[model samples]
Target: MTSATNPATEELTPFPDHTQLPDSDGTFVKNWQEHPQSILLTDSITPILKQLHPEGEYCIGQDLGIYWRLTDPPEKGAEAPDWFYVGNVPPLLDGLTRRSYVLWREFIAPTIVLEFVSGDGTEERDKTPWKGKFWVYEQVIHPAFYGIYEVQKASVEVYELIGGQYQLLSPNERGHYPIPPMGVELGIWQGEYQNTDLPWLRWWDLPGNLLLTGEERAEQERQRAEQEHQRAEQERQRAERLTAQLRALGVEPEA
Candidate 1:
């Protein structure tokens, strides 16, 4: 495709924007866990992301269409990952919420892309030319990290783009795949989230500390406050007992 700008008049040529892209293919094959999984991952890692992109120049796409190529159906040339993160892009495009991510308009690719596999998971790993999701990600879209998560098996596979090819990454000592740029590790955690008890995909810090969601952090703070209050009460009780003992011994207690 030629440049959107014409050098002759320096006028911008006609190009499709996010509004022009189709967001979905009208198919609903996602399981119940997919939506909550996306939220879980988003909520927990949001604090870290805010710190990383303090200026608020980052966007996350959850099951949103990323148009890499223009096709007849418009959705045919797109690959919508379960979740994706792209830094240095505004959450909104020119004060308008993005209907879809159009690569031709905004030349920025996502930093990481993840796919949640609901079946045998062959499609997520497919590498067929132009037709496979994996091939499109590795060759066309080319995110730095691509992850395939299978909740049924409680396993996740992460791939890194190295030397223009996707290389399977080995988990670190913490049994988590390291996403160095984000300074976090991706792994499965056995826990209950959104009222469902199962192994959910989660993120961990570089030192293997689990990143807490906003709700979890709030609960931790509440527990700490209660402990502090209990300690204060215990100290007050001890002081009162000492005062009474002093009075009983016929010594005047100091005010």
Candidate 2:
């Protein structure tokens, strides 16, 4: 029998490994509709970043906490970043909302973090006691960049971890920074998403320019087509006028 028709090859069945099984934790995340705009911003930027950095390992999402029990005993305090990332590490943490992102276990802390303020009037709380929280990320976590997106204020700010402290990375005219961790500068702007035009977080290049979404790109193409049509119409009208002038001069304009 030819190798192409080998029965052994056809009968091969893949077996599931029980020893290296996936995490089946039922840790719950309330539907993300609480802040619809933030959801769009997160959904839009993350997949692209992951796709671009296929070789690098990372995870970005909410309600999933990182458990930092790798070195110290599993700790009670777990911080859930709106969107957090750890480079060059497996994306799953015990298959559940991480108890705390223990750096030692994963051999790396999150490279960048994004915080979307829900505007529950806890700005002061976040600025003070929570200041220490981000401080931990700055001092201990040592993320290269930390972003705070304020939906109500339409403000986006990024803090770069510098010299064991958090230094605000000033935004250019467009309000963004070129962070190398994710290879994309995060920006805040007003745009259409889910049929609504409002403030949203956008990914940009190092040059501080907005990257267009598929929908936005399509809209631009439509606008360009309309402009081209108008220009052609204008040219046609001019040609007709010239033809009428030739007819009046008895030049007998051809059809």
Candidate 3:
């Protein structure tokens, strides 16, 4: 997607002046695994979307601060989801670093927001008005889909916005919640990712195929190449044996 630019000066304008906007206040501190998990989830999802819609555009945030002024004091109305995705928006605005995602400037709320429940359980499910993450997402940001993944329980709870309120979604037979708009399912996978052995929240296609990371895709390609090489070598050896047998029988095989 093309970044926002000033037509008058022909200069790149990523975002409006952020000084007037209330950015992050550091209310929530991230755990060690939180960042990695967020990265894993976003990284795995983006490539699939790109492949499916080559002309599509998307913006993904991993613990990136999101700013919104829903109250009289703008400072009090900002909340950042662990991982969020907004479609039809530039991945980066004017190739500049984003201080925070300003909803007014972007003019679009994230399509999906995912929160990884921290060990302390500070604010993952907070529903207090204006201050809680749940309240902010449901009332203010109003993402189409909201998901909370608890690593301890190895469970995922997905909520879909219906009639302006978030309703808990039911999982399918494979225990995955289908996100129809995205054509993907959200679920927990018990496996190792980035050398960490744990239950990781991941994405799957509607047909129950797991969305693979870049590393996993590369590994699969390598294995396929190796198999092809072995097959070619076996065929070559078989042909050579047949030629040798023909020569021994005093009938030279044609090249």
Candidate 4:
């Protein structure tokens, strides 16, 4: 872990907690799609994460910072992934919402980090040491998987950390990147979400089933119930017709 130094004394003081860090850099989101994109990724994976961490020992950060070093201006040392997931850790620190992930205090690196490309994606792919996002995640944070999703191209590039370096992963037969840690795959789906029709990044199970959001799952259940009701109505009408046929043949139908 990189250490922070106080410029005044040239010595290390106690590292600041999440409370002391600047949560935001006062930078506006690059585009309108960023928020919805982040939400789509998070919403679809909530059920999978709950099943993975049944005791609620997990954290999901959407557009939140992971503080790796203590810099003069704290936000400079942090890289806020568009979306990230960490397991085996409490969702909240001391029963409070996490302002940001402080690495020194919480030693768990995220299981996966995803960056949504709003620009030409040079920043996400940049490999300059101590500065670039790719270099930091590969060397400092070292998540199991890192994904770059580009909406403009309707494509995603996933990398798996192997032997201390990120290996660009190839999609499987289903055209999705498999993440074994969570037994799920990452891929893009052309769909309408939040009233926006776009290619949204989503998750799938190992069996090639798309993970549905809460609303999607609800809609599925509603459709299933309607189908069952229709089947029952058809059965009732068939039984009534059979009774009428028996009456015409001069045989009373049993009650």
Candidate 1 vs candidate 4, TM-score winner: 4
Model 2 deviation from native, Cα RMSD in Å = 11.9
1 versus 2: better lDDT goes to: 1
User: Model 3 off-target regions past 4 Å?
Assistant: 1-29, 51-56, 70-75, 120-122
Stretches of candidate 1 off by over 4 Å are 1-13
| lDDT per residue as tens, model 4, 121-178 | 9999999999999999999998999999999999999999999999999999999999
Candidate 1 C-alpha lDDT tens digits along 65-144: 99988799889989999999999998898799988889988898888999999888999999999999999999999899
lDDT-sorted candidate list, best first: 4, 1, 3, 2
Which one is best on TM-score?
A: 4
What is the C-alpha local distance difference test score of candidate 1?
0.92
TM-score of each: 0.93, 0.61, 0.83, 0.94
- lDDT (10s digit) by residue, model 2, range 149-189: 77678887788878777788877665677777566777776
Q: How close is candidate 4 to the true structure, as a TM-score?
A: 0.94
Q: Of 2 and 3, which scores higher on lDDT?
A: 3
| CA lDDT of each prediction against the hidden true structure | 0.92, 0.62, 0.82, 0.93
Give, for candidate 1, the lowest lDDT window spanning 10 residues.
5-14
Superposition error at 251 for model 4 (Å):
1.5
Model 4 / residue 9 / CA error / Å: 15
Error of 4 at 239 (Å): 0.9
Relative to the unseen true structure, what is the C-alpha lDDT of residue 239 in candidate 4, on a scale of 0 to 100?
98
Model 4's alpha-carbon lDDT is: 0.93
